[model samples]
Target chain A: MFRETTVNTALVAILVAVPLVAQAAGEPFIITLATKVAIFAMAGVGLNIALGYGGLVSFGHAAFFGIGGYAAGILASHAQSYTPLMTWPFAIGGTQQMLIIWPVALAASGIAALVIGALSLRTSGVYFIMITLAFAQMVFYFAVSWPAYGGEDGLPIYVRDKFPGLNTLDPLQFFAVAFACFLLAVLVSVVLSRSRFGLALQGARQNVERVRAVGIDPYRLRLVAFVISGMITGLAGALYADLNRFVSPSMLSWQTSGEIMVFVILGGVGRHFGPLAGAALFILLEHELGSVSEYWQFLLGLLLLLVVLFAHGGLIGVLTRRPHRD
Target chain B: MTDPVLEIRKLTKRFGALTVSDGIDFDLRPGEIHALIGPNGAGKSTLIKQICGELHPDAGAILFSGRDLAGEGSVARARRGLARTFQVSSVAPEFTALQNVVLAVQGASGATFRFLRPALGDAALTGPARAFMERVGLSGRENVPASILSHGERRRLELAMALAMEPRVFLLDEPMAGLGPEGSQEMTAILSDLRHEAPILLVEHDMDAVFTLADRISVLVYGRIIATGTVDEIRANAEVQSAYLGDDA
Candidate 1:
């Protein structure tokens, strides 16, 4: 039945979307939405690792995403500059190269995640959320004040970052690439969740005291999951920077962080494809609502409140499984 | 005895002027059924907590296998083969009985971090877990979540979890607290069988079950051991007759 819920949701999405995809085959708007789904899905997948699997309620993952994006953006800019690659210590040059950027993005976000996770995990429940938000704000304000790399104005790439032979400027090709990465992320998540460590992690979330009583440390298991979560989200940030050809402090804002969490909740917390479905619905809602009114955010908030108070389980609840009562 | 599995010397615990476990000394021998009986709030649960490293004694020495165990955490205590079942069942209600037991077995099997491989297929651990469940006559209910099981089944599942750890000593807290007549019978029978494996420290309210099963009885009252001996010694003791066991005696 647990497996059935996952399969059912996946089936419904495929069954429902074939016709729409056919209609929007060559349309630019369709391509944009597809990319949005990919991007948001990647970010949601990252949040799922911590929130869904590890039972951590972090509200500042946008900071990790934004850090990764900044790493990619800054490095690409440095590689093209006339100034030496780096001044102090060993000379370090930036790269427009995807190879170098991916690792940097991952490392930057991973380290940021590590610091934030270590501090936040020290406290439980509401305090963890507040501390993560505070740390993300610190990063956001730093981005705003720093005069380098366009500061609050943001940094823009004259040319999109390169990935070997692929001409990433081709919209379809880029979207396909993002989609492929998203699929890989999902596959990894499935494998990890079913793994033994995954069981222990889930067990810790369900009954931490019992887990400890049987000789498994919940904190250590959660720390590893958090790092992996950050790494995956950071990878998404790099892709996002390339897609927009820009990096801004706004990407790291607390609101952006909340949006990622909202996407997870919409997908259904603790669900496999819940995040993916949630991301699609969230972006679609925003796109459709934006056309109706400039003040669509107010309407969106109202709708979300209704959904939280009523639906609770998000899109996954309506489309797939009931809440786990046990 | 020189090789007693667990030795507690002058253990003390306080909750703001109320000394719950006051300077108590206890020892558990190998493969013995030791029963602790008392009214509510007599520090029975507190004693289990101190042994399992949940609550450290304000001042005492907890010697496991003749090794001084102070400052070791719960997991460490468990790895040293000291395990306990919560007074209120603390099992994963969402997981099947077999799955719950396997988690405990998996925990004791050392590293469970073999990612990218299905852990359910690990015959080494799950097989043993299944066997333990079968022993408790839960073979038919292996696939059902613990939440849906009867009160007795949940208690049995709790025992299976602690058993899967392969501990030398088990600290069972009220294994039959909420069971019906049938549940108490089933749980007591299971407890009887469990005594064959390792030394058990049972905290229970059922006087009939306790007197029937306990090889040695220890009555705890007001954070101190009121008496400790065979059933006859407890029944005959003057103070203990008034303090406890009067109705049954």
Candidate 2:
């Protein structure tokens, strides 16, 4: 079921890993860069779930991304502050635990997506896009106003956080953890896209009235997918906050949402590895552009506009020129 | 003998100043080829849309197998052993011929949600899809994408998609819309064979093909079924003669 297309795998691998290895040297940078790739890929994978296979153009994933970051940052800050977020029947202090934080981030994002998708699904065409963006903005402003986690100033993770055996301070171990999560997310996407619901989702996108005629409620299926997409994207956000050891209102901004989308479309819309390739290219461009000149953003913008106008299929589409089944 | 598979009574539709369906009534029996023919704007497509639940008639009751279908949507109607192929053949352009058929099969095979099985290239779908394509003369082109298919080939692919549902009744809208004489001949032969197993409501502008294959002809004029009779009776009807046949003459 899972077939990787034959390309210059070694070349792509070296291109991705070597620079990372060099910058990483002995410690932090390697781990941080690997984490960046893994986390961003996870976010891109989330976008692919809705946009690629499902054909939903959600322009507001930063809400989920920021939500994930807040989930980790808030919990860690609570633990650091020596104050329990809440207590059950008795009293319990907050703990910065991945086991707990992951589920919270997932559920929070899922629940938010459920509400957003439920309402957003009502409109089609340009209206649906605007509504989704509006909902994300609403949450973004709410995060900005809330004083919790240092408000606009942001909260710092005093500790690198804890995993079962991996040292939080060691870069490569942390990268490995993020990489495992990225792989799992990819596997989940592969499974879900081929799943029965996934087929209905794709069908619904291609022909909504047709699928409804077949006796399945397309709204319900799409909403669930949207929620799952948000949950996964939110998880990426949590990892991102941990990666930077900082969480702020900037994470929840519209620009962040726009950037994630740019990454997805730049790779190849709906292609499995499209997101990974897109994220890698984006990071490289950012680095190269930044080093080349201060106004590197102008070059990045020029490059992206060219890609969109000339290359309809993005990077993978440019490379393969043929459709490959994920 | 029993209730007809589909029953339409007093179906009516109007658009602003014009009436698209003027109080139409019809019945479709199992294993019958009911030909609905008329010149353009006769509302044949409109009536088909109403029956398939894509349009809501202004006044009417459509009962399929004795169950009311007034409130049902197109997809719901499709699930009730009713299927339709649009005049334009609304298909995913990116999908291959086999994948297109499998998508139809996916809806009917109790597996539309199995996103994990890699159904596109798998034999689970490919085997039956191949057989269906062979049935429709598309066996040789399974690997090709639907967009690149010849017009006749795409028409054949559309039939394969509709038949993949194993529908009780099919609402085919101009299945031979753009075929050449040879292509029309092939389509006519295919329809002749199809009428044996599946009841078909064929809306065709091709008079020769229509007169040859239709078991019963329902002649429409300006949103009205002016006449319904066997081919011999229809050929003799003065109104059908002046309105349609005479024009062709």
Candidate 3:
């Protein structure tokens, strides 16, 4: 608890304080960067639910992320053009409201997860990983070929989408929105890690047979976790697309999936604030070292190798200086 | 005898050419310990798996509470008052002993889907879980992670988890495999007392514990039951003596 508390406090302070201080100094670019950190951290938190707690290494999480991005992108696009999303399906219209977009993103991602998880959960280990990756690629290719939403050219949002009472175009206000979401996501993860479902999911990760012997269906539990995990990542994707005012086919790509996994591994899988710590370190390295050299990804890869080989538990493990629990 | 709680009839399993279980018939009545004893590779673990639904029998019927268990998953079997402990000490390594028992308690209590509220603070789960740990002789070490528990303590923890299920029957495999003489004695005493609560279909190689605790002994040799009788009958039988009891008999 001590190690967890320390890491959590540091994460909350850095995530909140850094943005506020940067805003006070009138560094709007830093605020935007901070918002990216929060959004990506939220995405890592989503993966942690499946990978960290449920022990499900779903390599296709970008499908959910892309679906979420597309949910926001298509909705905002339709709203901008004053076109209805569907004429046959009850004349569904689009809106720039964050509240509406979030639920739609969650539903879209959750359903995709349900379908994918139902198939993938039947297989495990490398097979599960490959299946998830294959599904993500299928979505990526579909997004690439679907020309209506710009396909490979990507879709652009004319303006930053609206929240109920905030001017989303303002970087600081948007940071607040993303930061609030980041907090909520972390809160959800924390609560879940200590809840009955969390215990069962974690139990399934440790030993599926034990969970089954105890009368809990591991398949059903993993599927629920997978859906919730996708919904969270989907929400993060929506916020990310809104932040950039664009949604690209690459959002659904395998690289995005890898990056989300990197956030979880780099942060320390299963640690309370592992994703935040990992996301912060990753973004900082990308911004700092990335500008210093053209081949910063090589250094990033080397750092990740070092973390896997020696640190084992990622950034949070290094911070805690002790063996961390799953 | 009246109808047994668990009855297995003609249970058979095979891997292509090799038959691991061959027309096995077994039963356990309430308030009795039915010990299944045999040498290594005699399919004791396979038999347990079939009863617990971890492995499907090629041809057989497992009747629990007089209902056929065909097409039912392990979870369904478990929910219907069937509890099993692994030979390999299979409690969750990441959880504390208390947390492990609480999970078993929650599994039986039907609140497994509840999220948002902190399970760490739930009195409904923790209270009964603590009692189970106490029952299994793990009172003070409840907070220790299962990974750090001693081998003997892990077996006890597994027992605590089984008790938390409030099971109608217990399928215990190798419960005394690694216990020291004192630990074995203590486990024997616990099982002797536990039989009054629910019947146990125990599989073990510890003859001392079995001879002391068993109400009836079934000797399995080469995937086939060679003898089923009282402890005195099994000890006196020449076939059981030659096959499994060996020269010591």
Q: What are the per-residue Cα lDDT tens digits for candidate 1 across A1-326?
A: 24535654563466236435744576655765667678778888899989988889988898999998999889888877745557788888788888788888989999998888887888889998899899999999999999887899998876788877788777666776777778788777888887888888888888999899889888888888888888888888888988888999988999988888888887677776767777777777888888898887787677678667877566666654566421
The weakest ten consecutive residues by lDDT in model 1 chain B span: B112-121
How large is the interface RMSD of each prediction?
Answer: 1.6, 2.7, 0.8
Q: What is the lDDT of residue B15 in candidate 1?
A: 92
lDDT of 3 by residue, B152-235 (tens): 999999988999898999999999988999999989988888887789999999999999999999998888999999999999
Per-residue C-alpha lDDT of model 2 across residues B54-124, encoded as one tens digit per residue: 78999989998888998877766777778787798666566778877877777667556555677765687
All DockQ scores: 0.70, 0.45, 0.86
In the range A54-123, model 3's lDDT, one tens digit per residue, is 9999899999999999999999999999999998948999889899999999999999999999999999
Cα error, residue B72 of model 2, in Å, equals 1.3
Better model by DockQ: candidate 1 vs candidate 3: 3
Over the stretch B44-148, how does candidate 1's per-residue lDDT look in tens digits? 999999889889889989998889899999999988787789899999877778888989998888787767876777788779999988888788898888788
List the candidates' TM-scores in order: 0.95, 0.93, 0.98
- The global C-alpha lDDT for each of the candidates, from Candidate 1 onward, is 0.83, 0.81, 0.92
Best candidate, lDDT: 3
Which TM-score does chain B of candidate 1 obtain? 0.96
Could you tell which candidate, 2 or 3, scores higher by lDDT? Answer: 3
